[model samples]
Target: MKKLLSMLCALLTAIGLPGCDYVNVKELQPGVSTAVEVRQRFGPPQHEWRNEEGSVTWEYSRQPEGAECYMITIGRDQVLQSIEQVINEQTFARVERGMTPEQVRRMLGRPASSQYFQLKQETVWEWLMERGSTLNDPTYFTVSFNPEGRVVGTGRYTKLRP
Candidate 1:
């Protein structure tokens, strides 16, 4: 009986306790915060879709070039209605913050307009890209969010002159 109890406890501990400490984005809840809170904690979303009803679909890039970490659906009221955070490449890309201008240009190619501005007293840069382009061959971009999760700027790049 003692041996059996010990084994069960060990198994339970192994299964319930995580071996490492990491902030998992999967556990975020919407009603817990406003849209601004979500942005502040997770940084800028890789992409967002806003509906006529004012609901927003936020796609958080899992990697700089791979899957999406989390897909959160928020209503116009600013509450979390649904959340899906499974590892799938179709949802989002893994992107990192604090990239230099040259590095961004190299990764995303040349921009149609590279603008620099000050917002809330912070310096931001935007590189607008053309549409129908891939990460391997990107073309369209209305705006790029900083790791801080703000629309710092916008730009675009195309084979033909605009």
Candidate 2:
């Protein structure tokens, strides 16, 4: 009976808090870890950037239904330089029209998901954030990028709940 009760409690907790999964920030060791290790642990990066100085940046994100989204900047030498969280209000405010995907990714990490419209020649990236009044319902911060990968516009939408 005790074992059954323990299992029931765990199941209830998991189902009740779907987005509260653990994201161990300490696992990322800047300046000591390699790009390959980062990829192996976190899976594929959702976005990547190559700077003029030859350094590269990779962003991995989990939002609305997950803990955090962060960026790991790797130098030209392939060593990790920085691990920064990019999921917050200040970051969202920085997104503006005409910004490059690289610039936006640096601020907001990877979006939760994206959609490409071939006929319109545009891509829409969406981030799910908890900014609405309801606790369970989240709002989406969307940025539309042109074919050239520049931000063309942005918008916000709230999820409807019954």
Candidate 3:
């Protein structure tokens, strides 16, 4: 019985129970919706900034287990202009939600510009360049999916190379 208890404890710790609690509106892609629409969806973001000229910028972020993070940015017009999701090698290895983690890893490695799929969830994966960040960082591609197992969108953001 003691051995079983120890095993259970170890499993719980490894699984990262109470994982990520992330939900935001700016995650919505740009060129699709306006700022007023975004404000209505997420109900005033956690953080907002405005320039002297009245341009607006909103930022949303979630830190998943293993210190991984997902961030999205929206411009003044309420357009989703940027997104950043980072899963270090370790966090990448621990993803067991939504389609086997190995499958997710494979998709990330061999990206073909665009891939769409629908399963227990829908996912559209793509590669693009992100705004901000110097040329030192490698380009990052994002695979975004919708709830009902349908991939509604995909995008990529590459950092400029200096």
Candidate 4:
């Protein structure tokens, strides 16, 4: 169901590129590209998730030398809004106000754990990840949501390898 649509849009953004250059990914113009055009370009998305706003984001990951993943957001108008690299600090920093829980999940994968604090009336989702270094020290990202299910805040920490 959703997977098929994601794929359709991946080719939506990724289909036409002979080389699939991530650098040139910026070429996808938000105001210009239609979902059909995107499907025709990229091929199929590697993953897909729908935001609370009812719009879908299609993911495309390039493996081997280029271990990069892209999140392409197509608006209800079926026009593109943005293309983002999901695996970097810059992306992590973009976790901002009013984003939905699903958007965060789509960007960072599942959290390592989550907790609901009755005192604060919020649910916190945490992810344990490997930061900049390959030494395997754990990095953590926590996104907090209010009772209404919207993102209210975020946190991050790095544990250096000993």
Give the candidate number with the greatest lDDT: 2
Query: Which of the two, 2 or 3, has more TM-score?
Result: 2
lDDT of 4 by residue, 13-78 (tens): 454332544424644578787876665556666677787797888876553223355678888888
| CA lDDT of every candidate | 0.45, 0.71, 0.43, 0.68
> Which residue pairs in candidate 2 collide?
none
| Top-down TM-score ranking | 2, 4, 1, 3
How would you encode candidate 3's per-residue C-alpha lDDT over 1-162 as one tens digit per residue?
A: 755644454354344331312323223456776665445433444445454655555533222112223333566555666544534444334333455323553323323244445563555544332323444544454555565543333334654565
Q: Candidate 4: lDDT over CA atoms?
A: 0.68
* RMSD to truth, every model: 14.5, 7.1, 19.3, 8.6
Relative to the true structure, candidate 3 has a C-alpha RMSD (angstroms) of 19.3
Decreasing lDDT order of the candidates: 2, 4, 1, 3
Question: Residue 107 in model 3: shift from native, Å?
Answer: 27
TM-scores, all models, native as reference: 0.35, 0.60, 0.27, 0.47
Give candidate 2's root-mean-square deviation (CA, Å). 7.1
lDDT of 3: 0.43
The residue-by-residue lDDT of candidate 1 on 118-155, one tens digit each, is 46444343232212234444343434555464544543
> How many residue pairs collide in each prediction?
16, 0, 17, 14
